[model samples]
Target chain A: MASTGAVTFWRSAGMTYNAYSNICAAIVRNCLKEPYKSEAVTRETVHFTTTNWENGIQGKPVTHEIFK
Target chain B: MAMAAMRREGRRLMVISPTVSLNSTNAVRSPLVSQELSLQGTRSISTQIVRTRMKSVKNIQKITKAMKMVAASKLRGVQVRTEQSRGLWQPFSALLGDIPSMDVKRNIVITVSSDKGLCGGINTTSVKVSKAINRMNSGPEKETKYVILGEKGKVQLMRDSKKDIEVTISEIQKNPLNYTQVSCLADDILKNIEFDALKIVFNKFQSVVQFLPTVATILSPECVDAASETGGKLEGLNSYEIEGGDSKKEILQNLTEFQFSCVMFNAVLENSCSELGARVSAMDSSSRNAGDMLDRLTLAYNRTRQASITTELSEIISGAAALTG
Candidate 1:
């Protein structure tokens, strides 16, 4: 009985530790470079051509030349 | 006698068992309830944070989408220019390759990031890469300097480093990477210090969701050499060698200038894509977290209500029994 109880406790503790470690690792990975990449891409895509909002045409033009 | 003793022991144990269980249960439950309440408090705080983050994420998404549309619109023009410039770089690189004994003394890294926040880890990753590079160059043989393109990069570097920082240009407009800006930055770097290698660190846009952090070597005669060698191989295969003059130094200078512009253009595209992806993901997580908290809170509220009702019923039954007695 005693041996069985000890085995059960050890198994539960190990499982909990593994779960916690996995969660921490995931949080670190998700919060790191991913956000920066997305932001950088968005900025590049939207603002690459328009330098000044006042002078540049607002909204994408439908019938503009494909290349300058 | 054995049966009588056994009966007494069994009764005593039975009596002791409930008391033990009641005490133990109370002991366990008190802490568990306290922990539950603490969890509730944390959940509330997390919910508030999620709400604020959601708002910000939505705003960023709007901006990113707008930016994506803009990039799509301008991509054709940028692609054309880039393709045209590739032809010009061929002869230039062959010249630089021919000159084997050029002096290389220092390395300078120009890091481009955004002035704004909420785009995500684009700036942070760039800064981390820069720090790693700086640490690598801490050896006696090499010296590294920084030319920052965004306010965020400047702020991050300033917090930890006390090295020689050259120019910092912030609030760059979203224009087709102006050759003039690249030239000005290049001229400043060239005039101020003698560097053997120049690297431009920025995000390279692969897709809306994937932006790769790239370290492009902008001012290396080695690039021209590689281009020439590659060009020669292609020409041999197709029966045409690249037509260009033998002024390797002049060609190298021109190639370096063109390389700077390409690096800038690539960086801008990458950073914008990264920004959009971060905002979309952040918002998605926020909405899911909010839903989870609401479910947990509803369960706790129901459990507490049920416990109170059971207590009231038990108290009324005990009062009625006392009255009957």
Candidate 2:
């Protein structure tokens, strides 16, 4: 268990280890070199399609894109 | 009058003979039709089979080509991320010296694999390595359990060693990999199982053509303490001073968890890169083989078609000769 010491401020802030580590990783990614930084940032983008179904009839698909 | 009557009889005989010959030819034509049935029917059937086979092979070739392209592009992206993520775990590895030969009684092997297959023998290689580790570590006092990371490994490992598996985590690659996600996964594994040490099995990306299955070990804080007390590889840890006097255990636990996540993230990235690379090569070979198969099938199809055409032409010539003579 990680204690609420100065070393683990992220945990005290109600962030899980994953979230803290992800923030750290994101910071590192942002600090990368010019071309690699942009490439890494863009690579995290996800594209998916969503459609609604009502009464066995499908609606038009909508594309959703998110960057994490 | 006798000559005319004789000519009329001859004409009548000619007409009756022609009609009898036509009926006799129709009777004989049934056997020719059977011969055509046996020869041309089989020939056309074979030709149709070859044509359909060629079509399917062509479709497979197209699919493989597209897969190869997709894999190539993915490989480039993963390769870049792998290189970048190397820095994330290198410091931890330096701080926590890797003791590959360290013997631990309770071991948990985390086998890294991918959800999708067709990436050569990478999953098999990792699974084999995991099994070998289990064999090597099996003893009266030693216990080993598996925590498979992907569906590919789960399917491969479940074939024989279902009992050894502790937990199998999938969908790790469902989204783009990041340190946060890997850390969360590491946290989940830490919460679930109890182990003296964790042996992470994964494929190391050596190059575009080479992937090496590797096992990296991370020791629990207690194990680290034990190792340091024994004055072995971790002897240097005793020299470092802790700022917070009573919080040493807490600090060590945090360090161990962080190190585990870092190493796991790197392993995941490296494995993904290797998978993509392997897929690219595998699809390349598949499409090439499909092209070769298509070529052979096309040759057979053309040959059968030409044979059928030749047979039809010979039949036409023979029938015409019979009609004229």
Pick by DockQ: which candidate is best?
2
> What local lDDT score does residue A60 receive in model 2, on the 0 to 100 scale?
63
Q: Where is model 1 more than 4 Å wrong at Cα?
A: A1-68, B1-103, B173-194, B207-209, B220-247, B301-325
* TM-score of each candidate structure, all chains considered together: 0.47, 0.77
Give the alpha carbon lDDT tens digit for every residue of B67-151 in model 1. 5455455554554554454454345344333222222347777777777665667889888887776665555777777777666
Q: iRMS value of model 1?
A: 24.7
For model 1 chain A, the run of ten residues with the poorest summed lDDT: A46-55
Off by over 4 Å in 2: A1-68, B1-46, B244-247, B318-325
lDDT per residue, candidate 2, B111-220, as tens digits?
A: 99988999999999999999999998889998988888777997898778877777777666767776556776676678667898899999999997799999989998
Going through the candidates in order, state the TM-score of chain A alone for each one. Answer: 0.28, 0.53
The alpha-carbon RMSD values of the candidates against the true structure, listed in the order shown, are 24.8, 10.5
